[model samples]
Target: MESETVTKRKTSNETNKKTDSLDDEEEIGLKAKMTLINGVTVIVGAYCYAELGTMIKKSGADYAYIMETFGPFLAFIRLWIECMIVRPCSQAIVALTFSVYVLKPFFPDCQPPDDAARILAFCCICTLTFVNCWDVKWATAVQDIFTYAKLLALFVIIAAGLYFLLNELQDPVKNLPRAIAISCTLVTVVYFFTNVAFYTILSPEEVLGSEAVAVTFADRCFGLFAWTIPVFVALSTFGAVNGILLTSSRLFYAGACEGQMPEILTMIQIHRLTPTPAVLIMALLSMLYLMSSNIFALINYVGFATWLSIGAAVLCLPWLRWKQPDLQRPIKVNLLFPIFYLLATLFVVIVPMIASPVETGYGCLMILSSIPVYAVCVAWKNKPKWFNKSLSVMTTILQKLLMVLGKSNKPAQV
Candidate 1:
């Protein structure tokens, strides 16, 4: 009887172990599916926005028109805030953030690295510079190829995620909701802030900066796959960074052409037809930015300004729709889209403002500094025709205000 009982117990233990293994596999599959869904959502959203912006420009009103309608001072402030301060600072912050994560394991106290690590860091910077200065077209093509690969990789990851989530279907409802809430909150905040950092500091040459999405994923998956992940991470991030550099430089080049900035900036090399000068200038400035310890603080300031501009743009959507009913919108933002964008923008603006007093103070000063620069460009140079129209509108508004006060019929008026 004792021998029989021992055998039955051993069999039951083996069955339980097999069941647990199956559950683990199912959980992983579910998690991958969820991740894929998230990835697709992002790709679709980005494509829509990019296409929409291009369509708007093609319709009639270009950047100048937008500037004229929005106040030139305000527009100039926005441009300066984005191009000069925000973009460069944000890049430095991202590099710093990644450096922190990469180096943390080696140094428990998070102290500066010793000579060996510093040497490695220097080598990385040199490599980054080489990548930036290489043939623009080739770089762009490479980036495109990698971007598609990254997307595919993300889909695979998502599939894995979904598989894992599905396997956990028997989990309690409260646990699931809590997990979902935490996951969404983390993804939204991290994704949004990281992009915010990218948009603020990104230039043509500096593109995606030090850390790519692949690098981020690799870091997360380090324990599971070890060295394999690092190789994939390097390839994925390098491609992403290259793409970012191309897009950013183009934005600056376009801005320069709009007469909102120096016309010299619009100049491109005839041979390459690339904005080599702008790229060089932006890269040098970004490198200088890297030396500063206060880089992240500066990024916070840029974040505030960037989000404010984005919020203003989103708010203007409703106004634009009502004011220019006939304006062709190839892709209209859904009502809910604008609302959520606004709320997100508002949160970004408020959070940094409340958190960093010095940054807020410096941001205000930077904005004021743009006024004199805009004045000189408008007064002496061949200003865009819209500048006159804007001035005329302002004069009309001031005159109307005076007339209203004058008609009040007080003794002081007599």
Candidate 2:
């Protein structure tokens, strides 16, 4: 679970942007070296998460760990930023990428139509949401199939580079770290070599200028087979959308489980035994986000808050070690892992302010906006009788409509 979850975190949609980012700074010559350095930094953070995931053993990922370590107040803030902005925006962006690739072949001479792409993206979200709400086994089955298909596409790219060079676990306590370590290492190598393949097939200027690096590489190297690239990319992004929905719904369910989110979100389908309400809410949010014209800008606007929340969660490692010396920890990372990861995270959140002040400012405001929301929805004890009655009635209606029961009911697993 951790391996697939972490691999999906390094979604393929961002691969081209990484090349563009390196070249945007006129550092094309050093892209390979910098990629290695960045990979090392990410591996350190992955280890930190592996340790935390092992200790907490919760579904919300960062949100779950934050709640355990930081208490409800701070946890709610992280939850707000994540559920309101990050997850939905990410799902929209990746789904849109999937649509664009799927439609690219038809519009060879031009960009895909926005309306068509968005409609396709909407359909993709709805399909994945239905699968997720139906059953966990079904979702994982989809994940497993697409994960392999995308990996084959990735290896095809890697093979073209050298024409050559070649390519989870039970007992999470002992095996989870190994799974995470191996997953991160493989991802880093694949990414690095894929970039090398791009550079090998296309010149530096070409790489910097091309809108879709993989497509361009395929055109250059796979002349008769150029069309396969778009198909491969579409499959990759579509699978990524499925993976994101699978994980993000769990985050919402975890929040509701702890009473941080609406009670409806904690309910699972009595028949399918899946988190139906939470999955539907995630799909609805992602669709709303797809309507935004500047989806990438929305991502930038939440970048600071995303890293900040993750850093806060990682910081909990050391704090917990000190605060609860006797807390059972099946896995404990070296203090240096969290120390380095926090430092990298600090650099991430702070540097963006100097580089993109407006977006960073908006990110800060978005996070701070949660305070008033927290005060009203979570913190304040007193509430009007009518408001409580309305909420209760709404929850009851939605539960029956969705054929779900609250966690308290403990519906039998299918």
Q: lDDT: which candidate is best? A: 2
Query: How high a TM-score does candidate 2 get?
Result: 0.85
Worst 10 residues of 2 by lDDT: 162-171
Best by TM-score: 2
How displaced is residue 398 in candidate 2, in Å? 1.4
Candidate 2 deviant stretches above 4 angstroms: 1-29, 164-173, 410-414
* C-alpha lDDT of all candidate models, in order: 0.52, 0.81
List, residue by residue over 312-381, the lDDT tens digit for candidate 2: 9999899889988788888877999999989989998888899888878878887899999899888877
Tens digits of lDDT, candidate 1, 1-414: 999999999999999989866665454444445555554443333333432353356221223334634656666666776667666555444444434434544453344453443334334444554555556767677777866665555454444434444565646134533444565555654444333322222322233343333334443444555334334334455554444445556556556555565433444444455554455555555556666556556676767777676566555556666676677665555666566656656776778777897888787787678788878764356656787566556534543433221112221110
Q: What's the CA RMSD of model 2 in angstroms?
A: 11.6
Q: Which residue pairs clash within candidate 2?
A: none
Root-mean-square deviation per candidate:
15.2, 11.6
